[model samples]
Target: MSLQVQIMDEIKTAMRAKDTVALEALRAIKSEMLLAATASGSKEELTADDEVKLLQRLVKTRKESARIFTEQNRPDLAEPELAQVAVIEKFLPAQLSEEEVEAVVAKIIAETGASGIASMGKVMGLASAQLGGTAEGKTISAIVKKLLV
Candidate 1:
């Protein structure tokens, strides 16, 4: 099933189970997906990759917000963002461990014969496509930078 349909089903399940956190998160995701689809010129439905990218963006936003809230000593504000992150995480593919990501990045560098920082773009282009939905972009970028250096 499509990611959107899976999310809708989970929203219903959450409601039936009285899981408010999950229900709210799913609603927010659905809202974002609809907004993205409508905003595009073609007005086409979002592909699975699009949905994954949307979810990742949402989680990243929430994490950054939570960090900012925490730094200001406002756990009250930070808690909800963290809660939403947890719910949004459920829909994402299992994230790659640091070791796993590093391993993959190393192999990509080797396969592409990337010897220096100048080849960073080429390595990142392949990694982004291969690692999308399985790793955070920032994490992958960091790994790629470290390896390419």
Candidate 2:
């Protein structure tokens, strides 16, 4: 089934189970998908890669919000954001561990023949395409920088 259909099923399940966090997160996903579908000049449906990218963006936003909340010493505010992150993550493919990401980055750097920071952009572009959704951009960038330098 498509991601949208899966999400809709989960939304109903969450509602039946009285899972407030999951229900809230699923609704947000549904809203975003609808907006994307109806956006001006947009296609009728998102491709699989687009869906993954959308989910990744949602997770990143939640993580950033959680980080800010924690920095302000507000655990209460951070908790819900983190909880939503957890719920949203269930739909995403399993993430690459740091070690896994580093391995992939190393391979891409080798394949691209990238040397020094000067070739960082080339390496990053290739790595991001190869490792998208499985790894965060920040992690990939840091690994590329460390390897290049």
Instruction: Identify the leading candidate in terms of TM-score.
Output: 2
lDDT digits (tens) for residues 1-149 of candidate 2? 89999999999999999999999999999998888889999997898888998999999999999999999999999999999999999999999999999999899888878899999999999989999789988999999999999
State TM-scores per candidate: 0.92, 0.96
List candidate 2 segments past 4 Å from native.
Answer: none
lDDT (0 to 1) per candidate: 0.91, 0.92
How many residue pairs clash per model?
A: 0, 0
User: Runs in model 1 with CA error above 4 Å?
Assistant: none
lDDT of 2: 0.92
Model 1, residue 78: displacement in angstroms?
A: 0.7
Candidate 1 total steric clashes: 0
How well is each residue in 44-145 modelled by candidate 1, as lDDT tens digits?
788778888999999999999999999999999999899999999988889999899999999999898998889988998999999889999889999999
- On lDDT, the candidate that comes out on top is 2
Please report the TM-score between candidate 1 and the true structure: 0.92
